[model samples]
Target: MEDKEFDKLTPEEKKARFQKAVDDYNSGFVEVDYTFRSVASIRVEEAMEDAGRVSEEFKPAQIKVIYEAAKADLNLEHYMNPKFSASHMKFIMEQEMAGKDVTWLPIGKILHRSIVDKPLTRDQIRRIKERMQRAEPKDSVIADLHEKKKEAARVPKKQGQQKKKGER
Candidate 1:
């Protein structure tokens, strides 16, 4: 669908259309047999749970197995393509530029790991953090003034009213 035409539908209608398309695709699916063994016989959810367990134990070998299984089952290659991943990084930079707090290190590490050949490194994480920090905005003078005004209002007033001792 063209962007203009797609904009005409309400969000709910758009979601319904997307779901229908997925249902139709699944119904028309076919299985192919190959000599190659499946990456792992586990379901995606189960693999993720296993990954979490391995992560808790800090075992890289166990984590690698789970990651491989997830990559095959979830088709992470397409979603984690460098071009797609860069766009997500760009979005995080934009958010930081707009004075929003966002962590880029974790996202960068995940993206680095998703690549089949390349592995994540500490240097990449430091670079991502540096870039995000550069994108952060400096404090505005007007915001400082507003904060001062609010702080002054919160102070208790001195007890020096028209009420003298023994005077009603």
Candidate 2:
């Protein structure tokens, strides 16, 4: 689209246009210059920790909106390296930060199988969500310990196991 054509669009229309560009990028229509990341560039993830921090003024929902807006701004600045807005990206980041196995998330499957491609399937996503909900934020060592405690309780008591057994 020409500058004059884009200029005529209202703010909302312009946003929609940019969003389409992002969608196009995500669908692999618009190729991203991976080299740009190697160059001095601001990473969205670097700011995520601070962004996700819930201040009295800013909440998680508010941060997400801000992050999405920033993504649009980044796309405007770096058209060749547009940011792909995946709903799972933030979730993955948070989960990974808490040391959870994000492999379960069907991020391999993209969201919308549009005129372009969707990496993930809805069925896969549903399955992943179910697993996540059932696990209740499964952590690494934490999960192991929790399971061990439950199993220990089930085992038949043999000769009274003391709390802190250390012979003098």
Candidate 3:
């Protein structure tokens, strides 16, 4: 609200407005998915029963199997991100059911792309890190290199001579 408009409210009216805003914000937190809650409860119970110890360490073969299964289950991978809450998924699904175009912001698009994209191998990731380190402070070094390339591509014009018409 504009400062002048806010100034017109009495103290009790201001307090009521603030309380309503707080209630509206807090209401979003109460919509929980029972299925997700149950799954979490089961995992917590299992962890407690196991005394926080892994019974059998995952071998390479077992890890591959689990990874493939997760990839096949789209919902599992989408919800794996820490920032994706149950409510967000529900809202998106509701929009889809209503025949609306479900759009994502750039950050969400990048996150979703990363989740489903083929992952780089360990060696590839290592090489990329090395390259990034070699190109540290990207603005200065990269800009200089690009500038040099552009200079090389330019043709020197003759001194004291105007270009002919249509000579570019």
Strongest candidate by TM-score:
2
**lDDT score of model 2?**
0.46
Candidate 3: tens digits of C-alpha lDDT, residues 1-168 = 668998999999999978866674444222134222233333323443444433244344433333333333323222222233334443333433444343431222122113123333445434534443444455787787886677677967557777899987
Reference-based lDDT, residue 70, model 2: 47
- How much is the lDDT of residue 84 in candidate 2? 23
- The per-model lDDT (C-alpha) reads 0.45, 0.46, 0.42
Question: Any idea what lDDT model 3 has?
Answer: 0.42
lDDT of 1 by residue, 55-114 (tens): 344244434444443433443222222322333433333444454444322233233222
Q: Give the TM-score of candidate 3.
A: 0.21
Write candidate 2's Cα lDDT for 1-168 as tens digits: 669998999999999978977886564344345322311123344444444532234445544544553454332111111132244334334444455444443332343211112333445446666555555545788887887798799998889756776753
Query: What is the Cα-based TM-score of model 1?
Result: 0.22
lDDT ranking of the models: 2, 1, 3
Candidate 2 Cα misplacement greater than 4 A, ranges: 1-41, 44-85, 103-118, 136-168
